[model samples]
Target: MIEPELTRCVASFHPGATGVTGAAKLSGGASQETWTFDIVHPSGNVGAILRRAPPGYGAAPGRAAGLDAEATLMQLAHDAGLPSPKVMHVLTPEDGLGRGFIMARVEGETIARKILRDEEFAKARPMLARQLGRVIAGIHGLPQAKLPQLRSLTATKEIEDLAREYQSFNWPRPVFELALRWLRDHDPGPSSEVTLVHGDFRHGNLIIGPDGVRAVLDWELAHTGDPMEDIGWICVNSWRFGEIDKPVGGFGTREDLFAGYAEAGRKVDPDRVMFWEVMGTLRWGVMCCGMMQRFRLGPDHSMERAMIGRRASETEIDLLRLLAPRGK
Candidate 1:
């Protein structure tokens, strides 16, 4: 239960918290816990969400820099002319809710499976892909020097440092080892160019509406890095949801998305994006290994962790197929 003082603190921040009630936990978030609440004011009622990072398997260090920076990055994205919810406030550790923030509950379609299967958004798929490209381009164009908060949170000097960090991890999968070597060797040339990357941007990460995209949600992984990381992360096959042919966020082709990005003043490099996608598969595979790392020895066994262990093989297979062409 939330303390009365903390509740009052939340209420004080927004005038809409007069009779805040029905606060319940939301589902589907594996890393952090999210709660949705109904706030009743004298004028009307409003819906809002709060995200908190609890002690978990994948929690990163840097308290203030974690979710707090996400809030600021979301604000920056909104300022950069992308569709995003308005960030109301960021809470400190003392706030009793753990590391988190409050934001307007954006109403739109965010589920990839639902969007792809639903008849309502059939025609809107292409437009959604185009808008996604444009939004990504906008994020990549942000002034690097202006984003000191993000720079402080990052562990690497460059985006490629992520690959190095991954290499250092004690991984159980051989595919990941091969991928790390490939990434290090390729090196994408040194990029002095840095920009804001929505660490996990994809179909489900975006909220699509009839008019257009309403909000870009989930800034937990926001960071400073090469723009192609964001591009490749989206194109990762895991997000494609079995649709191998449909590359543009599980809807349109990469060609259409690239054209859209080009129109948005961002140059699209197929090879660069492909590299990141490979990294995405490999990195996520490593992450799954980390999830099950505790159980590797024995005694702390979990069925979920074992299931995740099976996922690495498929990702490795995908990476191999992507790199090894017909004649290569």
Candidate 2:
């Protein structure tokens, strides 16, 4: 049977919409979820996506930029002509869909492997880094007055947070400790100009197509901080997906990425980006360790978590490359 409540909800806001069809879960966990469906209308079927915390899950967990904030960001980005989905409707209690939003869907490949290896993206690959740079510039330049409240982060604060999380693991990795020390010694402190930082801006969060980046997705970790953090994050080795030589998302050069940013009237501090690169590497390593911890002691233990724990060594190698590289 069709979801009568959801159909009524769509009809309330979607002009000319008769109902909804093809409702299906895309992905989610216990607390939040994503669903794909079509808004049936006399004009045509409209592809839309639903992101929600369901009914009982009241607020997003630590550091998440709650669903409401996410919707606002997407709408802001779309309005600014950035490659983002347009928010269709924000769910209300009467909708019976819980807390979340519906947005027009943009189709593309988010898998790093295919984006890097597939011939379909061959032309797009070379253009991605530069295009993404411009997109990020747009994101950072969005009118602050119109933006929603988000967590403000600084390099010093980030380093401290990462150190605390790493220490909690209690599993000593001299490399991680060395990296941690290096970050403290080189912390850039407060940026001269802070803007919106898409906290996770690589690989899976990007939607790539034959034409290049079709859209940027996932704003759960969006925050206010150094823009360079986005640059460094996209350059992280894990996101390279085996193409280590090309630093800018394994598809283009840092020079190209920076050039695009510069063309957009923004300055790029290479030194600061380098600093965050190391920090991002260490951050991923620590996260892998956390995965292992959860696997060892959790109600959600799974093989993927176990395997990811083993991948911690991957970060270790990447860390060494960053902190103590062997001379060529």
Candidate 3:
């Protein structure tokens, strides 16, 4: 059924003469879906992925960057010689698949635990921090005028947003309250330079192979903001997934990350990165609570939400370690 539509879609964009096969849903929810398939052609089978809203969801809710913007960002990164998928086609109504785009698939592993412990990625683990640092710099350096309209965020606005979202849950998390007060009292006001911030940059969003980061995926949370925000978010403890000692995604240190960023001719303010790290920690905690609310009250009743929601307490431990560090 969908193959017929996909066949037509690919034929228009790619000079292929045949159809599609092996179309299967990889992951999805109510708002978005990712499907993997092979475009059958006389040359061979070309692996492709479709990220769409399934013909019904009009736009991304809350703070998500719309799919159109995601496609554009990907194309820009690809053009800039950064690690990103090559966008193959942008869907139209006539394509009949929904609102989304097709992109060439990059092969890699996204699981954090496996990337941390597995021998296959052993060589990649150490170099990832620095390599990804350069990648982040490239992302921040993307030409602004060519970019699609995105929400610009500041540290104050981010704190307020997180605070409001947390208070709505009516959950009395003392650690969260402490973090909120600290962020307010030490508010750094506006940043000196605003650039594209990959709002969610972590293990799961990166495609890693033995060589290093093959491609950066999931620009759904991409936005224009303090460039330091991206560095801070990547350093959060929850993303480390147990390798707390290695702060940068459980593989490397802040020093290396900064070094890599500096290699790109960009200066970094260590103090700002530190502040955003704390903010990012508390933000993830609030999001965990939101997951609980969505699971209990929202339409989706999947157990994954409940599982991730239970990890909120771990973030409290991390917050304490960050804000009130003990002499070691």
Candidate 4:
């Protein structure tokens, strides 16, 4: 059942509304509930999406206030001229939808599986790579002054703390444990240049259209930290979309991506990218375990969640192979 507060807020947002009808949930979201709605206002009809926190999920320890902050970050990113959803309205937990935001629904294909297989984007792969570099550069270039509300959210943690936090999750997966160790041993000297890091930046999170990447969705994991974090994340093997040979979201080689960056006047560092790729794998592996833990938290009906836990093995194996080749 749709809560009255959500209905009221939706109506209020669209003044002179005559009727509002909600559609089904959008696939691929696990942390929260998302639904599309149809509105019949005096002016015209428009479609909207409503996202809300699930019961008992946010109450868990170590789970930060995500949805509300994500909305703010997305808006800020959009305002900064980064290609993202135009912010509409943000509802607090006090507002009764638990926590959520409504934004302009832009059109593009977001499903990773489809984007990889779709023939239309195959021809524009090179252009996509260049475009991706530009957008990433812009996101990394956001000024700290404009994002004051994110101070507590962007607090940097020591590498030791990050390492300990993942280890404490008690992931039973062997590969995940090994990746954690690799990260600890390879810890780059604590970098304090806190820039905006898109916690998860890969092919799947981006939407492609005839024009270019229409929108960059899913800011739930956005943070303030190393710029290389996003760079490494985009090149992670798991995000290669079943095309292991070609890196950078399976669109082009690392060289191609570096060219795009160089064209944008951003210095290229192969070693930094390699380091972040390792970190990206370890971070994802740990997150997979966290999702598995949710089974014990509440309803764990999602086969996708179970599969994500299983995916830790692939990440671990990839990390190990990268750190230590079979025959040196």
Candidate 5:
């Protein structure tokens, strides 16, 4: 049966759309959901996606920039000619569709492994890193006046936050401690030019097409911070998907990425980027441990969570490679 509220809501925002069809939940968690559907129109079925908090889920969790902010960011990016999906409509209480917004579906592959290994993305792979650098530069260069209220972060603050979260887990890893110490010692302090940092600009958040990066998805982790943080996160080894040699998402070299950023008129701080890379590595490891905690505690008690906990060691190894390279 079609959800009556959804049908009515789409009809209101989608001009000439009679209703919505094939509304399917793409993925969701306790507080958020994503749905894919088609707007039934006289001309054709227009593909769309809905991201919402569902009723009763109020306020985004810590560090989230909120759904409203996400919509605004997407719209701004699209307006700025970035490879972003067009925001179709932001849901209101009158629509009975909870919070969040509908966006034009941009078809592409988000899986890093597929983008790296699949023959279809072979041509896209080689150009991805440099292209992504330019894309990220665009994101950082977005007008400050148009940006929504977001949390401001710095390297020192992020390090403290990560350290606190790791301590809460009560799981001790000597390698993690070493990395933390390294971060503290090497902290680059505040960035001279603070800009929008796509807090998670790595593999899973990107949509790649044969032409190159088609969209930079998932703005949940976005914040105001060092732009180099985005660059470092993209270079994290975990996102490399086994192509460890290629630092830029396992697709290209840092040189190319820097070149692209320079072409976009942004200065590249190599030292700051490296500092954030170490921080990003440890951050992923702590997040994995948190997943395991959530699994064991309650709610999402799944094997995937349990397995991800095991993968924290991968970050540990990566941390060693970064801090104390055996051959280098």
Candidate 6:
């Protein structure tokens, strides 16, 4: 349904692009979609990706940063040399391809299990934690004036949001309650430096190659808040797969991550990072339940959602380790 429109769309933007080919839907729901296709050009074929919200979804409902905002952020990140895909064209009404933008596709493995166990990424594992740290610093340093209007989030507000979402499910989770209490008690107040937070900075969103992280994807959750939240989210136990010992995405230590961040001339607040780690763990747990809720009562019939929901208990174990660890 998108090829004919897509063909015309690319030709309108890319001077050399004659058309598009091999269009295939990568992922997403009815409202949002991701498609992969190659731009047929006279010189050579160019890999491209399209992220759209069909035509009728309206503006990004709820917390989404919107497709237009995503395009701007990706372009800004690319301009800042943060290993993000180069945004090529923002969809116009005349394109008839819905509301979205096109980006040059970066080749890499986004699968967590593959990047963790595959021999190709073995060398990169040790360096990723620190490298990602620097990337986060760069993101935090993005000039504020050029930034599109986004929600300004605080730790307290995020906690409240999570609590509301969890409460909406009408299922009482004891561990979740405990976490909510802890988060409120340990609220670090407002961060000294308010910058762009890459709302989701863990496994699947990172495009990794043999050398290192090739690109960061998904800016729909980007907000203005504590940059350290990014660090804590990556260190969440859910993201480490089975490598619990290696906290930094199961690759390296907090020391390495801090070292990389410090190299960017930013101070590391250990307390804030730890707090966010707890928050991230609890957030992921709540998200699992939310995903399951969607699966049980929505158009999204994804077994993956139900499977993820089953992992909600994993966060319980993680919370115990963090909030009430036994002597090692």
Q: By TM-score, is 1 or 6 better?
A: 6
lDDT of 4 by residue, 1-328 (tens): 6635556776767677666676567752446777777666778767777766754456312434377777877787798888888777887555566666877677778777667777877766767777787778777777776653442222124345556666766645566566667666766654456677776778667878856688887776666767667777788888877888878887767777777766766765677678788877777767677677665564775777777767767777787878776985
All candidates' TM-scores?
A: 0.84, 0.98, 0.98, 0.84, 0.98, 0.98
**Local error of candidate 1 at 261, Å?**
1.7
Q: Tens-digit lDDT track for model 3 on 1-328?
A: 5788898899998895499999999999987999999999999999999999988779789798999999999999999999999999999999888898999999999999999999999999989989988999999999998999898999999999999999999979999999999999988989989899989999899999999999999999999989999999999998898899999999999999999999998988999999999999999999999999999999988799988799899899999998998989
Q: Distance (Å) between predicted and true CA of 69, model 3?
A: 0.4
Q: Which candidate, 4 or 6, has the higher lDDT?
A: 6
Candidate 1 achieves a global lDDT of: 0.71
- Tell me how far the alpha carbon of residue 260 in candidate 6 is from the true structure, in angstroms, after superposition: 0.6
lDDT of 6 by residue, 1-328 (tens): 7889998999888997888899999997878999999999999999999999998789887888999999999999999999999999999999988899999999999998899999999999999989998999999999999999898899999999999999999998888899899999999999988999989999999999999999999999999999889989998988888988999988889999999999988988999999999999999998899899989998787899889889899999999899988998
Clash tally for model 2:
0
Error of 4 at 279 (Å): 1.0
Where does candidate 5 have its weakest 10-residue lDDT segment? 1-10
* Model 2 Cα lDDT, one tens digit per residue, 38-64: 999898998989999888889899989
- The 10 consecutive residues of candidate 3 with the worst lDDT sum are 53-62
Which lDDT tens digits does candidate 5 get at residues 1-328?
3357878988887788898888899899999999988889999999998999998889999999999999999999999999999999999999777889999998999887888999998998888778888998999999998899999999999999999999999877999999999999998888899998879888877878889988878899899989999999888999889999999999999999988888899989999989989999999999999999999997999999999999999999999999999983
Which RMSD values do the candidates have, in order? Answer: 3.8, 1.2, 1.0, 3.5, 1.0, 1.1
Q: What is the alpha-carbon lDDT of model 4 when measured against the actual structure?
A: 0.69
- Name the better of 3 and 4 by TM-score: 3
Tens-digit lDDT track for model 1 on 62-135?
Answer: 32246767777777777777888877778755665666787878887888887877788877876877777887
